[model samples]
Target: MTELPDTRLFDTVLVANRGEIACRVIRTLRARGIRSVAVYSEADAGARHVREADQALCIGPAAAAESYLNIAAVIGAARASDAQAVHPGYGFLSENLEFAKALEAAGITFIGPNIEALNVMGDKIRSKNHVAAAGVPVVPGISEPGLTDADLIAAAADIGYPLLIKPSAGGGGKGMHSVFAAEELPATLATARRVAAASFGDDTLFLERLVANPRHIEVQILGDTFGNVIHLGERECSLQRRHQKVIEEAPSPLLSGLDDGGAVRARIGAAACAAAASVNYTGAGTVEFLVSDDTPDEFFFMEMNTRLQVEHPVTEMVARVRGKSLDLVEWQLRIAAGEKIDFTQQDVTLEGHAVEARVYAESPAEGFLPATGTVVVLEESVAQRPGVRVDSSLARRLKITANYDPMLAKVIAWGTDRREALDRLDAALADYVVLGVPTNVEYLRLLVADPDVQAGRLDTNMIERKLPDMAFRTVDAGDYAAAALAARKVDVARPNAPGEAPAASSWGRLDGWRLGDPAPWRSAWAAPGRTGVVTVSGPQADSGTEGPGVVHVNGIGGDQESRTALDLNGTTGGELLWDGQERGYRVGMLGETVFLGSGGWSVALERLDREAATARMLAGLEREDAAADPQLRSPMPGTVTVVNAKTGDRVAAGDVLLAVEAMKMEHQITATMAGTVHIGVAVGALVKADQVVATVEPDEDNSTTIPEGE
Candidate 1:
């Protein structure tokens, strides 16, 4: 472990954030023997960070504007807790200049870069210009203050086709749009402006020439108040969806695989340091760059993140200073407390390989929609496994809301080589389990196992191109069998049935027993768009035996049939012999639904009786006989941000009627068929997942399709 700085650190520090980042900062504070205070919104009263801190308090309501992002509220909490410093753990107010000034006025130290650095690097447009003037290569673009839509459109001709519009404020892929043609510029620019205005309260926009096949690479840099700065290698963040990074790794494969003996790495590291030194930067910061895949040696400056990045763990795992692991958080705190560099840039070394995968609360099968649920069963035992580490904010019974970002945790792994590190990371992901809430763990596993990803052929748009061809796993016979066994176990462990004898009588036990061949015990399981019946015989589930039992599965997606003698055991977890292998699986039952988890994939099977099954089948048939349901339900829970069509408006198929914004994603609800639309929800209305937001009365006269943005 790296030793703590000799200088005196702050007695108490307030974490002006929530979720896994807050918990991570608190961990470092505890290690340094400093008091940590955590602030949370009302919706996060029972959050993991709140429970982990030495002292905790409610900042405000669940809305970020009224709570986490409210500078006054965070300062007030810090004052009340007697905190000498505040750590805005990336996102909320981490790089907000006003927040930093307010902290200075309140006599509290801001554990981040200096005001000059924040002002220069916090805005993308300004940072690009500033870095270019500082002798750093930057992407060709038009970046001016207060550029209107008309101005941007006019400049597109000069910038050429295929351009990128980026918001002046905010990072993490928010408020960025790619326009491939002149006609697409107007609408895409409008969206970029709206997102920028709402997310960062700034509508200033700029355009950049879209680089083809670009690989995102960022270098981690740390500085001290004494004007010393050093860089800790780079991270590869090429795998992304919708501009948000999904996987990140240190010592980028592009540079590491080169035959030139670390010359390119040195050049990139020098550029990152130069960017930091331009503004006398202090604390930990990241300088991101766009490197073309075809021209690996050439790179251009993207933007600098003025706060600690979410992918900092990958750097920390592989970066070493003076032959010891480095902790970026500790350095940030120490620098804020007036400490000088104990080691020079030459002391930093990249040892081994480290990879990190972000675990998001989303449903990949549902177009990667943000999902919510109370965490019923969370298995993080993999964190204790060798070469693995998990940074998470998950707790059993903790509710996941769509009010914030969908990222719930990050699982990181390290090994002696890149392949070994990747294997370890994949294994760690497979061992992860979260019941009740849907996640992208399985998708991440598949991505890791992809041929191109394994061979290090990556680009920012690779996920979008590969998603359609990726074969995601679905519920199979093994999953159905596991659910049925769990349900049967619950039944056999219960009291006697209505017509059966009391528990004291041996005959009361419903263990599928009979005179000769045992009577088969059957259970009906239903999922969305599919139903199945699993029958088990030749064994007593309550006998505590881990042996053979005959099982037959029928009618899941079709009239399919399967019969096998399975060896399944345990209540919460067990080893199941399926498809010629005995694989471990986890089981959790909530209400009437049984959840089976294996290899980082989980499926929920709702239990149904004969009557319910028959009724469902009839209802499905009735729906098939009638025209499509005109009602457009919200795919995910969120606040309605825009209602494009008012009530009684004649809309055609593919017309966007409304939009729901959740987890930083805006899902537009469109008309599936031409009809007269009746809007059900207005702007700013909170909606639940699957709640009808609008209804359309089919109109044969309105058969024409509406143009986009009409």
Candidate 2:
């Protein structure tokens, strides 16, 4: 390690990001006695990060491009706050060369790598070539600038089948495709190009030979201006969906389970250090590698992330420096101030095991569709428990919209070993609750408890392969019973019946009360794709008894009814004797809908009226009559970016009518039947989840197919 002159750290730093990462950075800044400034958009005015920051300023509106990604606005915020430095906490402009350059021009320190490192490592094509020149092993690939489709087609034959198509620009698994056969090249290339252009504004693409049963391992490295860099072990991130990581763990189980694990670890760590040294990388960075699960000793360099990573907490939990835990954020701040690292590579040690699960606001059962809703109930108290850590941006009444990423928070755990860490993580998730918005919490719990996952049988495609077999628990009799009981317990005043006068006395109750016994009150409840009713005959008020009573519930989509025993002790929720066991749940009401949550699973049951129920039945009948409904609805709330069909356009079934993009994920709305299409939305228009964006009138005789090239 090279020695360097001492330099004072910045007095204040402006965080050019939002959500949990910003709050995470502020925590270290506050510990170091540095003032932290937060910048947010119009949509995040009341966000948790803003409230926690010492100073906050509004930069722009909700659109990320105009707000979080606005280079001018972010720089202006830093300038106005007299911030000596700015921390681009992952995502947004974290790795943008222009943002770093602008900060340099503004005389503010960039709490990340220098511009040179960003330029080389930011683009996949350039980084591969740059590191390859430095004698680093990289996956076999064809990379070049301005490679036309024709050129790629010619090169595909040489690269062979099972090749990965990746955009040169952007990160986070966007615009990535895998082609297993030659016949799938042309169309896939076109789609990849379009996504690349839309996402990163750069259509430059490259191809690499896909490593079968590949495992993603990334080393956490910290570098200083003194030309010193050290690794903090590796993280296993093989469990993913659609190329996005769902779960990550530190001190990869594959390496730890190997006979020569320490030797392989040293070699991989050295290669990562070389990759960073090639560009003189400074501050905290991650060097991702593609390691074959069959041969753990052999690893290939993938890419170098130029900023702090979302899974850095896992590394922090297990990495100790000089017998003390390390804070990567603090090191980033210190490195940016020209301070030299006092510890060497041999001084770093891994103590225990840690695991992290990303809590995304998505419906895993609905093809991982992004969800939108206002957070009505929150139960993040699990973070205070032993061995559990939660980095979240969730707050009560927080509106989870489609304008930003779907990641709501991250739950991490540290234990004596891998099994203990996984156990803690699963328990934390089960205790975690976020109602009013659908989340993948239940799916995450199922994943951690998977047999293959627990056995360390991990690969990039494991999650995708196991999804078909994973049984995701949804709304059941317990959910309906809890909703009905919660509704009965509500004390809100009820309006008089139509043309009926208000009660003259307390004896004249409007709540189905009688002289001898209160009549049973039946209420209908509806969830997505299902509806049920529950009848309660007992007293509306709590009995204050330990014994449980029973309520009859009509199963969804069936006439069969069953009795469910529930104990309501005047609490927000009740204990349900369900699935041959007594289970407890927490319940809250948002409007007429009751949200019940337990064991990391939640459901929103809405009070349904008789007229609405009848209409729903009629719609179900229509669906039964025609297999194709002709209605194209936006699967998620987002902005409509592409409108492929216009009104009166004859289209064939499976033709894409429009695309709605939210949280960087695009879901195409397709015509269900051959017909004349009527597009209801245009380009750049905001849409709601499940909102009807287009409709098609079935006309099989007049339907026409779209040209392949078009």
User: What TM-score fits each model?
Assistant: 0.94, 0.94
The RMSD of every model to the true structure, in order and in angstroms, is 2.9, 3.6
lDDT of 1: 0.87
The digit string of per-residue lDDT tens for model 1 on 176-200 reads 9888999999999888888888888
TM-score of 2: 0.94
Cα lDDT tens digits, model 2, 34-106, are 8999999999999999999999999999989899999999999999999999999999999999999999999
Query: How many steric clashes does model 1 contain?
Result: 0
Error of 1 at 482 (Å): 1.5
Q: After superposition, how far is residue 694 of candidate 2 from its true place, in Å?
A: 1.6
lDDT of each: 0.87, 0.86
Predicted structure with the largest lDDT when compared to the true one = 1
